[model samples]
Target: MHLFIRATDAGAPPYLYAGPMTYRGHEGERPMRILWDLAHPLPADVFHYAKVNTG
Candidate 1:
């Protein structure tokens, strides 16, 4: 999938977010989890995650 992110201070979405991420978060260090779920659904027991980190 093609991902595009922009720098902003207003803090709202409809855009990919960026931050100092923690490993404790449910989706790990990935920023594409939500979109991935919508674009591609998988079984609850199945693990198929993807990541695309950029500034």
Candidate 2:
């Protein structure tokens, strides 16, 4: 499935298209941490932004 990510909902920030991803695995029932192998690698800037903002 395709993955889309955005840092925030404010204004009209466009969602970064993460491309199609394949399900790798998952853990836990409550939290459900999942692993996906992305078809295309995310750009360094986008990856950094997502990590910083989300983390």
Candidate 3:
């Protein structure tokens, strides 16, 4: 799955988010989580999400 992130005044680049994330199979499908705070990285159990260029 892919997520669209907006450009911020912060020095970080604008990009799409992805992750080798592992979520609880709630119902049947896994969910995606976006990590906006780059300074403080989130774990894989939560979602090691990152940004990538789409356009």
Instruction: Tell me how candidate 3 scores on lDDT.
Output: 0.41
**Candidate 1 error regions (>4 Å):** 9-34, 37-55
lDDT of 3 by residue, 8-41 (tens): 5378667535333433333433665433324334
Candidate 2 C-alpha error for residue 36, in Å: 0.6
Task: Give the TM-score of each candidate.
Answer: 0.17, 0.79, 0.22
lDDT of each: 0.35, 0.86, 0.41
Tens-place lDDT per residue, model 1, 1-55, is: 3333442436645455222333332454655343232333333322222222221
| Number of clashes recorded per candidate | 0, 0, 0
Worst 10 residues of 1 by lDDT: 46-55
Which pairs clash (backbone N, Cα, C closer than 3 Å) in model 3?
A: none
TM-score, ranked from best to worst? 2, 3, 1
lDDT (C-alpha) at residue 19 in model 2: 94
